[model samples]
Target: MKTLLIWCLPALAWAQAPAANPPGPWSGGLGVGNGLEAHATRQTGGHLLLLGRARYAWWGPKSGPGSKLFDQLNTRSRQTELAVLAGRSLPVGRCRAYAAAGLAYLLGRQLGDYRYTTRSSGLLWGDATYYYAYRRYQALGLPLEIGFQGPLGRNQQRLGLALQANFNPERSAYCVLLTLNLSSWGNRIK
Candidate 1:
């Protein structure tokens, strides 16, 4: 019985041990593929995160038939998003797979180009001006993200890839992002 017990002890000890590398609590990501999403996230407890995000995208000018060559259609946008999220991480092979969902507040600002035509001293002058045409609105959104991460240099920092979707009554956007995660369980989760 002593010999059998000694053999089982090693296996039980390994089972009780944590993995060599674990996902951290702090994650910052910059997404750029078709569009851009810049976000920072910090874990509050074991499975909850608080996030602040900002995004900017250039949609380009709008064109149509019956429009002159000089006719301008300017559209651009900037946005800010805040969220409180909950998530769980599962061990997959040597890495961790995570999924999170949250409620978000989005502030969107739409920019447009203004065209001004001026006549000075009976001389006709055509001028085009590029300025911020402000159209700001706020909406509530649902944000979802799924991804996998692995430790880079110890369990303090990790590198991961994620796919995200942000949806609201006004618009819906998605992103494929690369993330750098730093563990915040010890110091500040900022």
Candidate 2:
């Protein structure tokens, strides 16, 4: 029995040798989106969002901007964030639906104009000042995301879209993003 098993092991190893095609579980991509960020004080505004992302697998650990990274909504406001997440992915027809939750760091600032009239030399004149409606705050955040990606062609490239929400002690934000990824997910062997 040992001799027979040893003889079959060589054949099994040969059969399991590397194929012409390779599997690429790793993925990286870029994205663009729009965000609506609000403060606890009820100051809400829209921002143009930009992102960069990289990952290992849908159901495993990875790093990169899965949703958004930069927020330069207007001259009066700006924000930046980075996150680390744990997630799961599920098959949805030809697409994969994924969800992740993790910790993030948020840095944001906002400036507003404050104009008032003051009396000087018994005369009243208009005076202009600026105030931080939302003062610059850098704090920890909780980010949650849900999205899907699918093949773009016969190649490893894919197109994805996701909706993400960020919760922070100072503010919260919601974003919608579209991404393009290159992965070794579903490819034909030569």
What TM-score goes with each of the models?
Answer: 0.57, 0.55
- Score each candidate by Cα lDDT: 0.61, 0.51
lDDT of 2 at 157: 53
Candidate 1, residue 131: lDDT: 47
Model 2: clashing residue pairs?
none
Please list all clashing residue pairs in model 1, or write none if there are none. none
Q: Give the TM-score of candidate 2.
A: 0.55
| Model 1 C-alpha lDDT versus the unseen true structure | 0.61
List where candidate 1 sits over 4 angstroms from the true fold: 1-58, 61-75, 111-134, 184-190
lDDT of 1 by residue, 1-190 (tens): 9999899987555434443555355666565544566667765444645365555443434532213434433434555666666676776765677788888888776555544433335347544434444677899999888877764444355567877777888657677767656553444432
Candidate 2 C-alpha lDDT tens digits along 124-158: 65332222234677878887877777633334455
